[model samples]
Target: MDLGIIGQAAGLFAVTNIDDILILALFFARGAGHPGSTRRIVLGQYLGFTAILAVAVAAAFGATFLPESAVPYLGLLPLALGLKAARQAWKSHRNGAGDQEDTRAEPGGGPGALEVAAVTFANGGDNIGVYVPVFATAGIGGMTAYAVVFLVLVAVWCFAGRFFATRPVVARALARWGHVLLPLVLIGIGLLILVEGGAFGL
Candidate 1:
């Protein structure tokens, strides 16, 4: 209930998650006409975020017991995902109709919650790193307070993303470049995480 906790949590969530808005906006634009798309995206975001928080919680509690050397290797998760995405993007670019084909086929009737969750988790490697340190410093009460604020802010983020997706200029730009940029962004994040964590000493 401390105002300081709320402020810190809100600020961290907002600042650290700015990129999420663009990604979520792309999702919203892609699923524009699909029924239940909004619900699925929001649910998937929550699930993915919950997974990140779980990892953060575990690391914070067992920081001393866990091997710091292995932490940086976790970047591989996003790196592998980025490679897969790059392959897909390349294929889509090679085949004139490939992107359209992908658009028509939803993993489960329209970007099911699981698929979105996978992407969210893959994109959240940095979130886990940043959150672990914060959680490690906070007590149980403070952690709980931060969690509440974070969850609430997540909804706000989703709304903002959806709003952005509805804008004509934003929608067009995302539709055109999202596929290509997302993969590169993921790759960059992975490398950044590895370097920051001193993985491979680089």
Candidate 2:
């Protein structure tokens, strides 16, 4: 309800504010790499990011149509998500989870919107966690902003992915570190929220 106050304080701008989508865009691009070498995978990265953000925007809008209870609970998201990412990354490190290259995204080599979408949808393994609750507070303005930022970030990541595939070892190293780094960073941020909420006796 207090969108203005919240937005200003949070520096929220709609679609752009969704850090998860942006991260997905970046990682997908980093791993996706080499459009010339692998067009389908690169394109798939793009469409996948777009679809997830679109769903997130819709969910954020839906929050408005539904209930005010949605607003307060938004605080838990970044922390919970961040922690989850950390756990997943830790697991992936142990089990080689992030190591799997998508067969569809690879796709014998071609690029099109539909192909992109399919690859994207395929990469959409954890769709719900990415789209839901966060968007629950997104209004129309937020959604549009989210979309624009998300798209721009995706474009940048895709470009990077396509451009830089020569150093496979380095890229993979960064990718592995990213899995651990991003989540911990996000989790720390979430913990900050708890601090501000006075949940702990200061």
The number of the candidate with the highest TM-score is 1
Q: Write the per-residue lDDT of candidate 1 for residues 1-202, one digit (tens) a residue.
A: 9998999999999887898897788677666757788899999988988877777788888754335576666666667767877887687778776666656555444445775676677567677778887888897888888889988988999999899988889878867887776667667767876888899989
lDDT of 2 by residue, 6-103 (tens): 45423432333344344343344334433443454556666766665665555555533323333223335556666766676566567654454433
lDDT of 2 at 191: 60
Error of 1 at 191 (Å): 2.1
TM-score for each candidate, following the candidate numbering: 0.78, 0.38
Off by over 4 Å in 2: 1-42, 63-116, 125-127, 168-202
Q: What clash pairs does model 2 have?
A: 14-142, 14-146, 15-145, 15-146, 15-147, 16-145, 16-146, 33-161, 34-162, 60-135
TM-score of model 1 vs. true structure? 0.78
**Alpha-carbon RMSD, each predicted model:** 3.1, 10.2
